[model samples]
Target: MTQATHRPASWSVVATVRASAPVCNLFARHYLARGARQVFLFHDDASVACNVALHGVRNTVCQGRWWRRGRPDALEDRQVHNATKAKAWCETDWLLHCDVDELIWSAQDVGEVLGLIPDDVGGIVINTAEAVYAAPPSQHTMFRTPFFKFFFDERGRPRAYRAISQQAYGDLWNASKYGLWGHILGKSFIRAKADVGRMPLHHKKQERINGFLMRQQAPQLVLRHYDTLSPEMWKEKHLRRIRSEVSVPMAGRFRERQQALIAEAEARDGNAGLDQLYLRMSTLPPGILAECLTEGFVRVIRPEAHLLAQDHS
Candidate 1:
């Protein structure tokens, strides 16, 4: 663990990537537009050549493992190393370690919300929400709409809730034993000067680092994880993860779920059955999103108020 000796003025976004160019570029654009000084992106060598080639902002790039190597933990370890390496190259006072789809939004400017974080704090533990769209975003997506954001108490403890379609699917599509798939809770922001080692997917190990972990009492900074935001994007993402193993710790269990899904698909009519499964997973959610809101799954929040896609209504 290393303690940061200096704090700079600008902030940066450090991301470990395995996503497409457009997705990666979009991620970089979102942060840069929000005042990120630089983006430190890490990807495998296969993508190294063209990575960050599309970003129009100040940015840096690093490389992760090119092979699927050992357990999913090994890949996570590699990503942690990449994040650490990116931090070394970063000159900013604070950096956000996030993924392409996970947009960290704030009603106030992100930097301003980040300012609420104390100088002595190591980082803030933020909660995540799987923003389910009424349909594909037509205009301003994230900024224009209120989502099924995570419910966090004043102390930052998460209130997990299943989606509206919770009863639509069986155990295969159910939330994992570990936690709800989209309502994940974890760290999003970290102090640059802290002596820390990256661990557990989105967060790093802060034991040796100085200061206590602070929680943002207000919903100023909520991570909008767009795992199912668009049909094409969702299909591509889940298909890739289904065809290959992911670095998430619960991947083995996930794989079992996938296998069960595959068995059911085959039982029904092979590829057609899988197609049926995908259709159900994607299509049934809009009704549920509405029902949940009406029935009060997560109350419509202020600033974080409701705004569905215009065309959907």
Candidate 2:
């Protein structure tokens, strides 16, 4: 239960991860190197195979108890549990809840971000943007084509519909509840010192919930999402998500576009069936791609675009 004494000036990132995937480890390494003081890895599955392969790093692994059937009411119960544990182990004032797939980038260092945050400010709201990509050409390791990018508006709202963009700020309370997406919302923030048991703001959400968090505006930071890393992963994850149910209402259009993409991919590389699916999904609406390139968040060098254009031509 030892905690580090060093607390930086700005916000401290509090990341909660399952720690089973290689991507999670890569995320930890990248953020730790970039000045993240503490990272909490909540091990939901206590089986021997579930623990991450991180060695000699500042992290706490909490082996979560098994749930025997009924749906758990709290979505981010694990995060709340881990955060409480972190608070007891290491006393800290601020927490930044983020996921492995999301990254916070800034021109200034971590300290600078923290410095901008005022002590009176209970929490800060950040925005997320989806990074899309087309399929890679033959023998290439990564996707090469540029697609349109989505942006979040000033009030921490996502322009495109994405559940992860909405978040909250507060300390542990008794009645706090986690939503379907594993985020806690609709709770009173405790202004004074209070014990965990006595706090009424515990996490508790009765029904499925999603959307934005209300808070003061702050400097812009990108929450780059790599949800669609590949076409195969895209189809698998998207189809499996709760949002997939929405597509059923729009089934005809979905099927038509899906078939056309499949045809295009097969035309390009039959063996690359997965790649074809990815290209179609990642293709941004015509003008959006150019807008993102002009903004410089996307790397659309002239030669690469020229080669892609030639191939299409």
Top model by lDDT, which number?
A: 1
lDDT of 2 by residue, 1-313 (tens): 1222343442344455543454455555545555555555555434422334444234544443334343234435555555555444433344455655555554557555554543443434444444455433331212233332444333434332222212211111111111011121212221111232221222212211122122434454444445455454444434433334222232233344444554555667774775544554444434544544554333332222222322220
Report the alpha-carbon TM-score of model 2 versus the true structure.
Answer: 0.53
Mind giving the per-residue lDDT tens digits that candidate 1 earns over 1-313? 2343342346787767766565566667667766787787766435433455534343334323333353224455656666676677777767777776676666667776666555666666666655544445422353344555344434554443444335434454543322234436554576676665553355544433544453423366667666554544544455556556444554455545654665667577865776565555433366566665664443343323223222211
Q: Locate the minimum summed-lDDT window of 10 residues in model 2.
A: 172-181
TM for every model, in the order presented, reads: 0.71, 0.53
Candidate 1 weakest lDDT stretch, 10 residues: 304-313
